[model samples]
Target: MDIVLAPLATDITCAPSTAVGQGGALIEARSDREAITRWLIEYRHSPATFRHYRKEAERFVLWLEFRGLSLDALRRHHLDEFEQFLTNPLPSSHWTGPTRPRHHPRWRPFRSGLAPASRRQSLVILQGLCGWLKEAGWVTHNPFALMRDRRRRLDNAAPPVIERYFEREWWCAMWKLLDPPVEDAPQRSRFLIARRRFLFGFAYLMAPRIAEISRARMNDFRLEEGQWWWHVVGKGNKVARLPVPDDMMTLLREWRAELGLSDMPPPHDDSPVLRALDRRRGVTDNQLYRVFKDGFSMLSDALIARNWSQDHPLIEQLRRATPHWLRHTSLTHQAQSGIELRYLAMNARHARLETTARYLHAENDEWQRQQARHRLSRIE
Candidate 1:
């Protein structure tokens, strides 16, 4: 197993100052390995962040080793070379497709070329690491300081290459497939899939991020003056109250009844809204994502098997869908409905109203495209 691919944060058996046998532990430079290990250990409070930082750090370290370079020996030019490598990994290297499991023989740090945003993020992490090393007196200077400024100006930028959500037809298909035994299945299995339907439906209606949805407690929802609202702690720890659409509220009531609970949640109930498999605890973000992906994959496969054209755009989108797409789909659909921008922003818990405004721009662009398509077609 590649040392870089070793379980991050949990494997402390590797020596602090050297490679761990044939596993090829990262931070290979003897002078800086111990310090890097200590820095990683500090992230125990946030395992996900630790894992992400470790992967980027490990990639840089291994790249250094591949080029017979060390952290202390790096210069501005060397950093440029590393940036280039991130954009296009060596074809002959062990890296596999991004989806390959960690244990795969061909697995490499990068599965594909990093997009502009990803490349920038990777560089930013390295810059922060260099700054930390400089502050700790391990390195004489931060090499990142020598790198050119690459700050992103989000304003006036064109939309991303891919719109990360489904169209109405595909979206409705996804929703419909959530119910009924489309094919023969056991009662117990069907019941659990019903729970998954509610999860996805709730996600679509609320437009909540995965973290917010995962952390939701039954008590977080309330019926104030007969209007349903969900209190969520969204990104940046900002607390916001979001209105629950009537249809979503009805779904919630049905789901609660299925769980043998009252249709209306109690004011102070601490029970998780999204329960674990045992129904004894809250679901983690990873688990929530799995539920969504499983549901999506099943829907996609069914659509493909239904004699839908293989090259249809809807099918293509479903094939690449992730949990985040649900949030995007909700917001995009809301925008298309001509909801007030300020209200949409509030519902999304966006810190910057500009973030919410992008949806408006995307909608306008799409409308214009349709008009152009019609105009371009000469009359029969």
Candidate 2:
């Protein structure tokens, strides 16, 4: 069944389904529900986000079809089922990212997102959709509201979350860690290695979002008054001033030279920073990811080629790390080094001090001892 959201303005003008916007989305919406949904079309959602939600809605529609429920027939149980479906996805529907991160040549498990985390995100979306439906009088109550939330949990006993500084020894291997340039790589393996290394490097040093990295314009970096600084448009559409490490600036300047970008550049601050090293086109998110995937595979293959396995603590830790983990590493280490939370917040581009605090808290021995004492002293 096509799940239609309420339209933008009054009279409920029907906007296109995400698939329609994509120009080739599948037929998952029921004719009736498709007719009913108008709000989602009005609500602000990116093309990618809409497309993802549409497909997920289609999945639910298909499952509803399996149970012979029409759009008008959906109740609390139906929404509950949808919630459970997201929580305990069929093995067949599981998503896999670059397992080895294309860091190495060998195939590693693509285990970046946890099932629970994904489930919660999906539920949140589902809740929003269902709440819309209920408010529109399509349903009496939202079924999704009844479902319990799941947390992002990983067992330290078996598969622990990776925690290690991308300091020197780890750093040297990490940049080239993912598979080296693949002769057969679509963007070529060599380019992938170089690009992701830059991405990994830039994010740690600057703490920009992955999207910001992909959208980073050429003119964002500047050497002014003998100091290099990066002007970044951060999440929530906020503008931020980020410190440009001298070494990172060197790499930036070099990459710009390779891009044939001018030393005396245009005045625009939003030009993409990291670009396609392919020499044919400017980079998109896909290129960034492709490079990342291939790079990780290459990196992993390098480790395995030398007979490394996940059983090794270092390899296991690397296996669990992702790009955001690098951001976390930077903030954690900065905080550990006695950087004030407020200062780190500014550098981290955090709008809220709490959000930065999560990254800033040091969980080492000294902090742990404090935690123990606090717990011991707590009033029962």
Candidate 3:
């Protein structure tokens, strides 16, 4: 393929022409291009990856400045400190998707759950940077060649809510049946709670990733052969079909009509399946999360109001109670409701049995204990 170098940050292509200055030095204002920067862009590493390189390099530069060593005079210790900085730097507010929003309704930082594999990926990139500097004869040695990290704990490689959210029965009642409070929210904000309850009930009950939900346009949903269904694009960009709840079908209808898009916009085949009050901003992963947070918080508040102590047997043993928890509830309810595992796998849209196995995580334990204590109830 022919190399196409887009001029970065300016109108000029490559470097501008330079003539010899009076002192017999080339009149170039900056140094010539390096090979690694070319490779980074050429390898299809995202612009965000390039941004990280600049930031990480700056961090290394700062550490070197504290020790009074310029890049030309930098040594192994400088690179090692930079590695440490990446592992446990200042709290990264730079995180995107679910964790980016500044308003922490709970007034706490999102817990950083970076996985071992992720840290390893970052470390490998740094090592590669060091290797490149050496190969290009820019450095005498690859400083990080011998340096190592105590690999980050294998963390949940998803946003925090993805790890913790589980929809139990108590939570469902709290969110769906009871409308929780929002502090000084605008009239439009009232939709926040409702959005969560129904969306959670609709989607997680069916188990589509937030990405699939966002990617789903009205065209992807259809009444195929008289059944309401969604054509979801799952992980790895694969397509899967899902059945939607009738109540959800209604919610979608009202929400669209309320927004008046039906007048200005076309039918189910013409617009996004999920949208916001403000159409242009679009739906986001964090929006998906904030939907849950509002739901969970409202639910938690409602349960407290209804004369149920957090210590009550039902509430007391609720190990998890976020939106994903509802997913567990949905699956368990289906299992108890006699939905087959085979059908559950398809409805849940999990590619592997082990992935769906997580949905069954607490079910077997809950079932056995319920059966042992209520053995007489099992008799028909």
Candidate 4:
């Protein structure tokens, strides 16, 4: 028989249970579910973090339900089994399904089995949860602690090299398609063309994440001390002020005019910078993601129509590109253009310098040049 488990509610808040763990309890949470909920509450202010942590925790709980075990009963062997399960997620009919509403009868814990990187991320989140639970006296031990080389396994010593970004030639080709001259523009509607130009321009120039752009309003862009700045609430609920270049300001003005607004946004105007075609409401992140996906698909079709092979590298890149690739492209290009590392980190809003350093490819180029000197017989 297939196992059925209802996903936890996002707004779950319940009074502490009376049960206690093996250790002297510090938190009031008694059951494993309640304890996990307590841990999730700490990240309530950070929606992205909360959602991610909750998903991993919920999946573990559901897996435990399948095995008829509890968090407190987990051991190194159980942890090992869970790690293996993450890779395959057996009984596919019960564990995997297409995306659906959380409350939908057909909703499943996973859309598919986790990839290696995703599995690592899932383990990292669960490790943190287990540590917290141990501190709260909800569990007797943390199974992650028993694993050898835990630090190397759980944390990346160096940031992974960024590969999911556009090359200059690819970016130029895409821009040509996006911002063709009036005489050369494709059959797309004027409104759509204008929106695409502004949307891509904003993404490439500001390098804001999809959520930041979707939630932005006209008031977020303001003239401050003779300079334009974009105020944004970024990841972890951190607020930042990013400098807006003259070209970006011009683009904003043109986009506003296209929307029938004044050249310069009026002070305190809360209108969304990007809006629905038939309505004034702001678009959701999912909608913005679709916009990028559709744009890439169109670009791919255009290339194919022009005799580009289906298996071309550029075509493959476009097929795999997601909205996040824009941020990667912007940062990587900025690094290549000689932007200092410190400023790049600030612009990217990364907490660590190492994270920003992943975009630096100058060292790789120099290394390649040095390696070229080594040969079976040096050519004079």
For each candidate, the alpha-carbon lDDT, in order, equals 0.72, 0.56, 0.52, 0.85
Pairs with backbone N, CA or C atoms under 3 Å apart (clashes), candidate 3 = 165-325, 166-324, 166-325, 166-326, 167-325, 167-326
* Candidate 2 Cα misplacement greater than 4 A, ranges: 1-39, 42-62, 70-80, 91-114, 147-193, 223-226, 260-271, 277-280, 317-322, 363-367, 370-380
Ranking by TM-score: 4, 1, 2, 3
Residue 173 accuracy (lDDT) in model 4: 83
Model 1, range 96-155, lDDT digits (tens) per residue?
Answer: 354444556655777577767677778877777877766655566677776555344122
The alpha-carbon RMSD values of the candidates against the true structure, listed in the order shown, are 6.3, 9.3, 10.9, 2.7
Best by TM-score: 4
Can you write out model 3's per-residue Cα lDDT over 9-51, one digit (the tens) per residue?
Answer: 2122345323322332222223223323433443333333454
TM-score of each: 0.75, 0.66, 0.52, 0.91
Q: In candidate 4, which residue ranges exceed 4 Å CA deviation?
A: 180-188, 378-380
Q: Where is model 4 poorest over a 10-residue stretch in terms of lDDT?
A: 179-188
Instruction: Compose the digit string of candidate 2's lDDT tens values, residues 185-223.
Output: 654445545566666667667766566677667677766
Summed backbone clashes in each candidate are: 1, 56, 6, 0
Query: Candidate 4 residues 1-380, lDDT tens each?
Result: 68876786556656655545664667766467778888898999987688778889989999998999988889888988998999999898899996676778998989788877788889999999999988888888899999986776698657578888999888988887886226455534766778878888889989999988998999999888888889999999999999998879988887887677888987779989898886388898778888988888888988899898999988998987888899999999999999999999989999899999999999999999999888797588
Q: Residue 71 CA error for candidate 4 (Å)? A: 1.0
2 versus 4: better TM-score goes to: 4
Model 3 scores a C-alpha lDDT of 0.52
Off by over 4 Å in 3: 1-168, 178-190, 261-268, 279-281, 307-329, 361-363, 366-380
